[model samples]
Target: MGTIKDDASLVEQALLQDEESKRYTGDGSVDFKGRPVLKQNTGTWKACPFILGSECCERLAGYGIGINLVSYLTNKLHEGNVSAARTVSTWTGTYFITPLIGAVLADAYWGRYWTIAGFSIIYFIGMCILTLSASIPALRPVECLGSICPPATPTQYVVFFLGLYLIALGTGGIKACASPFGADQFDDTDSEERIKKGSFFNWFFFFVNTGALVSFTFIVWIQDNAGWGLGFGIPTLFMGLSIGCFFLGTPLYRFQKPGESPITRLCQVVIASVRKRDLVVPEDSSLLYETPNKSFVLEGSRKLEHSEELR
Candidate 1:
């Protein structure tokens, strides 16, 4: 039989390769290789377990590091309560703030999958550094004796914090992308998949708290009873597992293409508004710039009606 072309727009170009028999997903998502994906084979709940698994371990790993940090700083590093508290607060802020950088990169350039994968390596390296800092004698401060404790040397401070900040950078990318990446597995255009997407979020949060719970309860106890080396080491190992789990589910994952930078879009809006500051408001909402087509002006998005409240 002669091959059929995907181009079927009447009376022309029918002599190409046969059309794909697969029922492609309607959500405009593609497989990891950028080809159309079969709806039944990829994504949905099948891919969620891996994502959830990764999230759980990652959250566990993150909280494992953070929960006992104040104690480590004061007791092990010989930092004063005030200094330790300040350091913890600053590190926490940096950890959260770095997500903005991840978000921009995911949206503008790297796409979510690559961003998560790339940052996870950084996170793992940081965890390893932290583990070594705890396990190696030279990396950690000398043990305290009685009432008088020597301060942590400059070398000790450098090694510990280098690991700490690297984790901040790694977790930033994961935090920014993981949830949305999970959501991408479900097709928004399909009614069934859309409902499933809601359920996905519910399970996603459940796993998140599950991880946190384990870290606070089990990991905290380990740090207290066990040596610092083992305590930090457990989380580091889990962080590695987190990376493994994510990669394990790579084949089942659906990917969305990165679009224009949101920051750039925001700037364009502000500039447009400033230039149009003197223009009178139109009485009819239909007078606003909006296309009536099924597709939106923005790629991979639906058209939204203009709202008068925003004006």
Candidate 2:
């Protein structure tokens, strides 16, 4: 009997140690299958290299196209300096602005992973079209001598601009979600992981600049020395690789579930505030309507404690 009791206590202690050593994250992030993740098995530095690779390759492709686009417009498309500048500026604006649409989709409906994946496809298609437009003789204006160059036909213009705008739309989606998605890999509740999250952003920026550096120097050299086809094609390949890296990391990713529309929440808050405008303030902030649960009230959002300063 004494031996049995000793063995039972030893087993209980081992179980207790296991439980203490392994704690799940308080944040509502789950694995790809919508199951709770073990900190030891998934996320953190393990998943970062893939995310960084995706971002790096994407920036390489994006910046590669954007940097020399003005020259492509003037020399290849036969536009004047002002026209080329204006066109590039317009496209850049579109690229930056498209993120708003991506943000809404990621936050309210699709979440980050799917948003990035979906947009990457669009981006890849655009790159392919752009490469083809440069490579195929029929898609581009004829090469000319001196200052006299043949103007692009309507069809040529349509093809080139179609590719360009598709790239803009796709990049918007990628830019909106990539950073947040990377950040999601780190558990916010864990102090060590939180520190790593901050480090991830630092390295993220570093890799972004690294991509741009390669784009500016190496890709521009290729565009100038080699033909436009190869220049565009190489970046297209990089874009494909970016997509590959992202998908490969999918198994390890921690997906933050999409939440209720923030816009709807804001509208509700406004309506409620206006309706209660005449009510007296409660001295006890505990009377305010906040969820009792310590965990997330919704997948992506936590209930904030009521504050007097905000009122």
Candidate 3:
């Protein structure tokens, strides 16, 4: 904020435009078209405690599982070190990379709020299934045959991977929306609110580390000393609490409409340029067909026809 100067960018103006569109009703909810009317709340530091607290718990729940994943695979699953490492790597890679897909879904279709909410359920379900697989006799390895450990049966494989990949998908959605959603709670127009929003990111990272720390220490200990079931179960409980806290803050959240997808805009640009390639290039910028309204057109971009007739 300090270093950057000059005029505000088009995205900033678009953000302001979004803030302006929020129609606050006398009722608890605000008027938004696609989803159910969102609970109206001012985006302020005062109202952001719920979002922060929810994030802490969500991190704790999510981190608890991954931190000790190698141990669980090696000890309980009776997997060799190399195999366990590979499995953990694949699982984590999937968890992180799927966010790109989720971001498109969030920005292009579902708004951030609903994307987070919907995915939180999927995450919770994954946690439950993972816990169940860890605990149940049939889901994990049965008896060790002499020196070599038996591989997981087809059913066990299905149960375990289902839990693992659901987690991947769910975490992807959460990662895409959570931070931006948190920042969305602040009114960017106000100097004070904008500062608070910037300050919030610093605190958010702090809390995130706190979650990872606790999971690595306490949660891992429980799994090692007590049982895998108890370890995995604790995170599931925290995840539920995380979801509950998120919903509880509905009245305090600063909701926004989903932004347009860059991919879609780019594709539109390409299509329009290619279709008009052989035609004479217009000398005047005004000659290009454009919509007057800023609401629908890409910010700081040449407005393309909204109609498919551009083809």
Candidate 4:
């Protein structure tokens, strides 16, 4: 992996890495370690598709779970709309909040690749469990007596919610990392590469919709008409394929190093602001703190410039 001098501060270290990356390429590229930044100098399109494909299939698997869940609850377990919808809404809330935890951890410690990979594995296992819960006669919901369907037993509730939460945890982390990791493939310093990054995001959303469309039309239909085994199994297969696709681009993909913790930085800002609340505002723009280097201003995104907005 690439690195800067140990003595330098975060901003300086980032600046040096940026300069080194741009300046050092080809036979003249990269100093000290002598490793090339691009192994085959592969273009962005080639490397990015694997990630895009992974996300597409991932969405197919995830949304496949969502599209017909109400029907599964109502028809199979004889749950009312209010009850099933409430359960699903609770699960959805957990799925959304878990991503924030994942993002914080990813920036603080794990690189995007590892975080996404780890969470994906967890997600796959969860999907498998879900399939088993649906397919196995013992694990699945029982038919209702007349119009009244008994609530799930503790054992059944535990088994089902466990699998659901695992998917949430895995997809949450994957969601935070996937786009930024894909964007990392393109060289921001190059205008062409930047444009390619923008294009990747556009297509990324397109693929998401494509997955949702297939899920609603095909996966939902399969669950309705075919056996639940086949319906759930299809998305599981897609997820398996998605994981395989992500690994295929390993050689070509550019891996990024983890940096300073966002959690800590946020704490510092809040704490400092509260502590200095009584202090007089400085009129001079130059009095504000900023990195010396233009190249590496921000760790996560961009460097902030001293401006009238502060006043």
- Residue-wise C-alpha lDDT for candidate 3, range 123-191, written one tens digit per residue: 999999999999999999976768778878888878888888888888888888888888776654346
lDDT of candidate 2 over 14-40, digit per residue (tens)? 999878645666677889899888888
lDDT of 2 at 137: 99
Q: By lDDT, rank the candidates, best first.
A: 2, 1, 4, 3
Which candidate ranks first by TM-score, i.e. highest? 1
Q: Give the TM-score of each candidate.
A: 0.89, 0.88, 0.75, 0.81
Q: For candidate 1, lDDT tens digit of each residue in 157-251?
A: 99999999999999989999999999999987778999999999999999999999999999999998998899999999998999999999999
Candidate 1 global lDDT: 0.89
> Positional deviation of 40 in candidate 1, in angstroms?
0.9
Ranking by TM-score: 1, 2, 4, 3
Scanning candidate 4 in windows of ten residues, the lowest lDDT window is: 24-33
Error of 3 at 129 (Å): 0.4
Segments in model 4 whose C-alpha atoms lie over 4 Å from true places: 1-36, 39-43, 145-151, 275-289, 294-311
